[model samples]
Target: MSDLSGIWVAIVTPFHNDATHSVDHAALRRLVQHLRQAEVTGLVALGSTGEAAALDDAEQDAVLDTVLDAAQGLPVIGGLAGNHVGHLHARLAHLNTLPLHAVLSPAPYYVRPSQAALVHHFQDLAERSHAPLVLYDIPYRTGVAMDLHTILTLAEHPHITGIKDCGGSLDKTQQLIADGRLQVLAGEDAQIFHNLCLGGAGAITAAAQTCPEGFMKMYGALREGQLKEARQWQHLLSPLIRALYAEPNPSVVKAVLANQGLVTTISRAPHLAASEEARRAATQVLDRVLREARHIGPESNR
Candidate 1:
């Protein structure tokens, strides 16, 4: 498989307008171009940040197609957040037909299956998946955490190649790094810097959508052991990350993107638009981050 290292953005789905709220393929293509310019390693479609939950299967497929087309040659990872093993197996069967780099699958949410059941669930999906899998361990949203033992056990599968580590347990993160069996990518935006310093492979960060250049620069610096430069960039980016999540997910994110005229600030129901204060804060922080990120080029080139 190709190395799943470096930065990947959890792309937000763009809507046509608040009235119809239909998927805006044109805007999505433009957004993809914007991130590609930042030189992100990959793009993730239908993830949490992409509002996967809000989209129906057909809508999701259309969104994925648009992204795949816009991504040019960049690998695009599709999100799989199903609770039913049978359904997911079937879903993976269908996804296998597409040319995706990998699928990001989280533990079945709300159901909170046992550790043993978790193993069975993932194994079943991996068996059905033609592509490699990136295990997602976000307990806060998923309602179930994969124990270290369970994760280690899953790592034995050839197809279960990596993890998006949002389990929020320091010990688990460290142990995974020490094992060196699976590629560990930081799932949370705030932890990206700390995870990298501890030898994480990369991050599937939502905050990167706002300041892709800065995030890429930080990753480049960390990979090259440029701790001081990476630290400075992370510190500057911390505020924007905080503000982006100040509201639920893409709320503040869409607001910031809209402010920059990248996409509309229209989000589906259950997720309101970001507060004016949050938008102002994110925009202000973005301004500063973009200015600094321009200077953080590839360390090897530097």
Candidate 2:
């Protein structure tokens, strides 16, 4: 909706028992407040860190619905990623009934599809969804790398509003920006500054779920032509990102939040909870980040 610019957060779907198989609405409401106070531009519910794969269809709808309801004015993009195009279409159909800005769909995963197939899948999705669509290209997660030529090809569709490029290849990202008119947002938490410098849009980083203010500070500094400060802040966040992700993502992040008294540190099956040492490390990093983040002013994204 608002051109999908600036810092968008791929929010973690907080769970009660470290099992994201179900979402805790109260925790989500708290998260919504954090994101809003942090002044993040958008919210992506049930994204990777959200552990969408571990949840059911009902869980997905509930998560999206609750976040949109809690956000009030903030734009909410339904995170509708699955390995099957058919299932994605179904989910998009469901989200169409809600008040959302767009459909944040990750590229189809497993048994790698060709770029031609990918283009078709996305175009088909665009045609079917009530909301605009943003493509998510994270080859690491999907195990299928999308070439620049193919990305440019998909961007040609007017219905395709933007993309969350998580491939971690700056050269490829640069080429896409150079060749297309697509709104390109960085998906990797570590590349927000570099992405803006390379002419890309903002970030929908998972880490932003907790460090929205700090990330926005880096974004603000970069936008003001202050790379020196931007780099400094980014350096400060680098360790936090690494340590939080040392375990299976939301697991560690959730645990850190729980320790900090924000939400329950829960994860579903296939993902384990963080170790005590990891929890301690994550907490230490989070405390320092929260302190430094305060200097940025949008209130800590607790």
Q: Could you say which candidate leads in lDDT? A: 1
**Model 1 misses residue 279 by how many Å?**
0.8
Specify the poorest-scoring 10-residue window by lDDT in model 1.
293-302
Reference-based TM-score, model 2: 0.92
What is the C-alpha lDDT profile of model 1 across 171-224, one tens digit per residue? 999999889889999999999998888888999988898888888888988887
Best by TM-score: 1
Q: Write the per-residue lDDT of candidate 2 for residues 1-302, one digit (tens) a residue.
A: 33877888877777776323457889888888878988888888888888888889988888888888889989988888777667777778888899888888877888688888888888999899888989899889888988887888888888888889887788888887776578889887778777898878888878777677788888887887777777778878999998888887777888877775678877777887778899898879988877775554323221
Model 2 poorest ten-residue lDDT run: 293-302
- Cα displacement (angstroms), candidate 1, residue 148, comes to 0.2
Over 4 Å off in model 2, which ranges?
A: 18-21, 292-302
Q: How many Å off is the CA of 84 in candidate 1?
A: 2.7
lDDT of each: 0.89, 0.81
TM-score of each: 0.95, 0.92
